[model samples]
Target: MAELKEIVSTLDAELDIKSFGKDSSFSRFIPRVYEPLKFDWQTAFEKDFVELFNGLMLKGNSTVGKVFLAVFPTDKVLERFIEESNSGDLLFMHHPLLMECGDPKGKWGQGFVPIKEKYIKQMKEKNLSVYTCHIPLDCHKQLGTNIAMAKKLNAQILVDDTLNAKNEYVLYCNIEKTNTANLISVLENIFEIPYVDFEGKKLEDIQRIAIVAGCGDVVDWMKEAEENGVQAYITGEIHCHIDNDYGKQKYNQIMEYASNTSMSLIGVSHSASEYLVHKTLMKDLFEKNFNVETVLIPQEKWWL
Candidate 1:
């Protein structure tokens, strides 16, 4: 247990949470829409504000035998993990527990999802601890999702000047002149995704790139890329839900912006883009720094 706390402390120190600021402003609006579901947003902010959604969600035992890492804690994944884990095992994930929050109409809201109560009960029964590191992991300079992805593409990572509302850094890279098709092929191979979505000019016109791994669908990031002279932008998801009117509008706007600006866009599955942070960066960090046994379980691709 002492070692586990030490490990968490070390991670907190290494990430420098104090410098990142405490306000969980992103999640603040969630409670207003629906009662804070699985985890209390306000309490989390009040207790450990410096770390942005980074802490032990469920306190288990004092000692941990092994650590299991994943991008999200889906019910099946969590159940399987708990079944295979011993009493003192720990589950470290990027996203938090999925919670079902509804609006006045009783329909599910945009950000909230259904909570898996059975999974939580199972974890408690098995005495398993659940730890999550969302923005902090994404903001880490050396092992962040964007940096890891940039390194895998073999692009010359220039600097981390791009900033998001959460104060996270987006990586800018200069890749040897590569066409859009070839770049898409490379990304597909790297992420093991079958297909990718591209928007904007001809495939051959892509050169300089900007990378923001998981949720790069933000318009501000796109504008920043354009302002920084980025010829191509790569991101996880592109918000193309045909059934959703708002999503369709956002998608069309992004496509139009890319076309008008002559900038290219490539998007892959969100899980695939961020999985490398667990499989490569966290694995290496834990094994090298703490000499701990770590197992990385990739989130199953839900695209079928």
Candidate 2:
């Protein structure tokens, strides 16, 4: 087995994508994080497992030799996973099968309810390796949704947090001299989003702005952006309560919070944010081995 660093180096070379950068969303991947994360590739998989799990890790110094297509499942989809395979073969799913967020100090507060006995037992028996990419995939520099959207719109990076090890948000510029009406028309034509709201009259010097993939319920952050002189905050969704309670608007409603401070909110289904990752990852894998095939899980739910 190749050393972990070697594997990472291989991935870097093959993907041609930078996953870490300074001033990242949360400064997500710091040196301290590197210390605790392990890169053991020694786990063995069933003979057939290699067809199932290898190639998912884009570039590695050593060959994992195990790869496969994983079907994505939703909470209600409830397709029983083939758990009893082999350990160390990582299962990279698009959705988190075991995720909940809160203080783990209490049982109720713990994130991610464990799967039922039938599923857990099956996984333990098969020794299948399971993992989910979720936001990480959506935010990946090369395969992420933000980059794809930017490409579709001919947008430029105003603040590129794509490479941040912490891997948080991506802020890209759409149009500088374009009028708001034109910008809105362009966005509506290109994306699955239905509408965009304007806070004030069309904006000038509108070339500068920030965008989040889905849901901007993080109101305080937008407020902070306003203080920083940001012309607009574009996102998929924001809390509707902000309208009646604070802004008196509908859930998808876009608001002009203050003069000289405005935002454009674009609401698309969450799946639209990361659907491109499947194809992007496939391309990376193909560079390493052309015969290898990649597939997107069928369970991802969204339109367009």
- Output the number of the lDDT-best candidate: 1
The regions of model 2 sitting more than 4 angstroms off are 1-72, 75-91, 98-129, 134-145, 159-170, 176-206, 227-232, 240-261, 281-291, 298-300
Clash count of each predicted structure: 3, 36
lDDT tens readout by residue for model 1, 14-118: 776556564263245335433545554444332463245466666566677788888766666686788888886778777664422112122422543433556
Tens-digit lDDT track for model 2 on 131-209? 3344444556665556666666667765544422222563546445665667677766655445543344456456655
Cα TM-score of candidate 1: 0.82
What is the model-wide C-alpha lDDT for candidate 1?
Answer: 0.67
